[model samples]
Target: MKPGTLHLIPSPIGSNTDVLAPYIRSILESVPYIIAENEKTVRRFLATQMSSELLAAKQFAILDEHTPFQDMPALLDPILAGQDGAIISEAGLPCVADPGSALVQLAHSHHIPVMPHPGPSAIFQTLMASGLNGQRFMFEGYLPIQEQERLARLRFLESLSSREQMSILWIETPYRVKSLFASLCRALREDTSLTIGQALMTEESFIYTATVGDWKKGAIELKKSPAVFAIQALPVAAGLRSNKSGGKAVGKPKK
Candidate 1:
């Protein structure tokens, strides 16, 4: 029997299901099996796009961060046996920042054809509106939670951005949004440009770009919401100069 294909389905990041492509329903309806980050959440989302009977009839298997590597290959047995399957992320595109990548890799090893359906991604959405260097940017994902390590990583990223004139992007959990913003204000150069994309694609979405110095002048409550942060350091020749204290290039001007 011919090996079945694997479909990569992107889920909406927010309450709006309209962001999903119109062709997604047909893909969802055709797949007999699904691998998802969270079974409950996937079922909840499918309820919006599929009939109650159809949703109940679909078979689901979990493949999240906690899934052991040994157990992953079993998730593909049905597909390998000629039954088409789909992978759904908890939010946004599958396998970008999600754990679905492991299974996708396994599918590739077995020569299973993989098809990805385009949909909303918070990372690109933020970069598009950031007004930063769209030509060159890197997504750093999540920073270290330890204060000192996180600070060191921030400074290193800033230095790299300064030298290369590239943008750096990362994300934080909802509860840590304000805390991370505060840390960015303190750890980065005052002249560095920062962009905040909060609660994107939702009713409460807020996106703003400003220098670190400008952001420090006012206070805004970020509350607990998903946010993407981007930073572009001022070019070395623009204003950055060698620091006398640390012997490193400093982007902030002496106050």
Candidate 2:
């Protein structure tokens, strides 16, 4: 029997489901089996897109951080046996910042085709609205939680960004958002550009970019919510000019 294909499906990062295109729904309906980060969340999302009867008939397997490496191959057994299957995350694209990359790699070794569908991703969306350098940027995912260690990492990223003129992106848990923002304000240079994207793609979404000095002037009260942060340090020449001018460097205005 011909090996079935594996679909890499993306889930909504926020309350907005309009990003779920019609084609994605069709693909979800076609697959008989699914591997997801959270079974309950996936089922709830599927229920919004398809009939309850159809959702009820689908088989699911768990694939999160705790899933053992040795057991991943078996998750693809149904697909290897000629049954179409998919991998979905609790939010955003699978295998990006989320889990399931290993299984996708195993599928390729077995000669199974992998197809990725488009959907909302907090990383990309944050970058898009950041007003920062889109041509060159890196997603650092999450930063170190330790206060001293995190400060070191922030300075390193700031230096790297200044040297390369690239944007550095990372996320923080909702509860840690305020603390991370506070750290960014303290550790980064005054003229460094900082962006905060909170609750992106939803009705309550907030995105703003400003210089570190400006952020310190009028601090915003950040609630405990999903957030992505990015920074773009001044280029070497710009840094020197700003320093000579008493730290008043023009940056992309807050948006």
Candidate 3:
């Protein structure tokens, strides 16, 4: 028999209401308990679509980084008693460097079903459009909040790009994009390749992927852009373990 269910529903990246009507119907009809990062924010965002009354009647609980682990039992008992719970982060997939992991771990240990409802994900989209080597890429989640730690992280990622021959995805808080980009240039090799994806799927947003040397000389700047950066570990090559290196890469130029 399947264990009591837990769902990881994908909310929109930056906007709420992007989930299609069929998806809304499916979630509303299926979920008995809703675990959200911010209930009021979600309520307002969903109100324009799902309406106020129904969303209210369906109770939601707050579960973020601060929620005590001991308190999880209280939340878990109700869920495991056959209440199918849905966890929605503010944006994108839960537990992708987000706060949904502890609850997920609790659910898995208790033999609960942890299902990921597939939908929009920016990281994959960035990699796909990046024109960078995607097969051996690593998503490092986000850059650090502290300057010292953030610089350290950047250096580490740059080393990963040089030593591993694997692409690395770098993310940052929206406000600090310029600082991060500046720091990235300092850390990476002039010829090291980088891909920048900003405000994906939106008319105002764009992506620019290229090498660091060209990036410094390019007209495009990510200073004001909300972006996800994917850095090519090494020049693109056919075989992963093969010692061959320095094959000239072919990719679309960024505008």
Candidate 4:
């Protein structure tokens, strides 16, 4: 029997399922075994995308941060037996800032064919709108929650971005959005370019790019919103500051 292919399926970032290519449905229909970060969400997505019948018929194995190393090896058993399988995340593409990568790595080691289907990704959507250097950017995922470690990481990434002229992309849970934004405003240079993409693709979606100093001046509320943040390093002088409406700081173009 021919080896079964491993499909890397992408889940919806927001309520918009239109981002998925038409071919994705066919791919989803082809596989019966799925490895997902959240089985419930994946199943629900399948039901919405195709049919409730598909959801009922499919088999799932959970693969998240809590999934054990020992359990991973067994998860590959179905694929090794020439059964087509898939990996999905709670949101966005699989294996990205998600534990699904381990399954992909294992699939590669066994020479199982791994195929990717294009779909919605919050990281790319944020970068596309960031107005930053999209050509070169880094996805740092989530920063450490610990204040000291998080501050050190912020400075390190900032220096790297400044030196490399690359955009730094990261995210935070809905509840911590405000805290993380506050931290960025404090730790990053005043002139650093920052883009905040909140509630992307949803009715409440918000995307704004401005200098750190500019962001500090505005009373933007990002609490309880899923968001992606992108920062572009700028020479302190080149990244000048401007005032918003009422003497509030705003990002000025790099000279």
Q: By lDDT, who's the top model here?
A: 2
Q: What are the per-residue Cα lDDT tens digits for candidate 3 across 16-117?
A: 456543665567555768888888865665565565566767768888889988887667776777778888777667777567798899898898978888
Task: By TM-score, rank the candidates, best first.
Answer: 2, 1, 4, 3
Give Cα-based local distance difference scores for all models: 0.86, 0.89, 0.72, 0.82
lDDT, residue 145, candidate 4 = 98
- Candidate 2 C-alpha lDDT tens digits along 149-185: 9999999999999999999999888999999988888
> Model 4: which ten-residue window has the lowest total lDDT?
240-249
- The list of candidate 2 runs beyond 4 A from truth reads 249-255
Better structure of 1 and 4 per TM-score:
1
What residue runs in model 1 are displaced by over 4 Å at the alpha carbon?
241-255
Q: After superposition, how far is residue 23 of candidate 1 from its true place, in Å?
A: 1.1
Pairs in clash, predicted candidate 1: none
Ranking of predictions according to lDDT: 2, 1, 4, 3
Task: At residue 226, give the lDDT of candidate 2.
Answer: 86
TM-score to native of every candidate shown: 0.93, 0.95, 0.83, 0.90
